[model samples]
Target: MTTTPERTEPSTTAGERAMLEGWLEFHRETLERKCAGLTDEQLRTASVPPSDLSLLGLVRHMAEVERGWFRRTLAGEEAPPLYYDDADRDGDFHPAEEDTWEEARATWQAEITRARELAADRSLDDLAARTSRAGESYNLRWILTHMIEEYARHNGHADLLRECVDGSTGD
Candidate 1:
């Protein structure tokens, strides 16, 4: 059984960067904890009928999101989608039969590491190297906040999925 990473409680009064990063990390670990101890088949089980939102799919989706926001938009790299593309926009949410829990977890963790490295030296007000689809530039602060919000929203779905999988639930 794979063990879940420990989730630290974000400080109540940290600075802006610390608070944002802390909350983001907290949510990241929360997702991991929600998926912990499940078999690959279990992780891939679309327990929620009509939704097909498996835990492994969420992990894969987050990896693509991390790569898109940090590696592509923020750093201006030509990092293309890992699990999705023009023809399959929702590919990440539908894990292929070959997808494994271990691989998905590793990819998600790698993206998180790269995201931290990319954001380390930038100021909150630092503009991204690229602009949004609407041509508006996003600062580091916005990216961090958006990432946190993204994780928070998915974590809610994760909570329900985990319960459906094994009757396990908590923060």
Candidate 2:
């Protein structure tokens, strides 16, 4: 049984790095909170008939995102996709139907841990090894903000997915 990551998102506002970390942590915790107490089946249940979205899928998706951003792009490591493939780009969310909540949560937590470790020694101004869709390189500060946005958007979906799964909702 893997232990869940600590989720004490800082309440006190601080510097730019601290603020970004707090918001990112808050978003990560929101995803974990939505998945908490859910059965594997509940976590795998899709939001709707046409939509493949689920709590488990979101967790997997975020894990992939974290690895891509922090390891592949930022760290200049030869990191490959953890879930998806060239033939099946959305594999992370699609094949998640059979994923256990425990497995998905553990993988997500591990990715989060790795991302924190990668970013610890870097400054906000550090440049990434990858470029954005616009063909422009970005910095750690941008990556952090992008991560916050990514999780925030997905967490909103998680809100609906959780509510749909069990009618649970809150901050």
Please, what is the whole-model Cα lDDT of each candidate in the order they appear?
0.92, 0.87
Residue 82 CA error for candidate 2 (Å)? 1.5
Q: Candidate 2 — what's its lDDT? A: 0.87
Which candidate's lDDT is highest? 1
TM-score of each: 0.97, 0.91
Name the runs in model 2 displaced over 4 angstroms.
1-9
Model 1: per-residue Cα lDDT over 25-86, one tens digit each = 99999999998899888889999899989999999999998999999989998987888878
Indicate the residue-level lDDT of 141 in model 2: 98
Top TM-score model: 1
How well is each residue in 1-171 modelled by candidate 2, as lDDT tens digits? 534445776668688889999999989998887888888888888966679888888999999999999999899788788789998999889654456877877888898999999999999999998888898998999999999999999999999998999998886
Q: What does the lDDT read for residue 54 in candidate 2?
A: 85
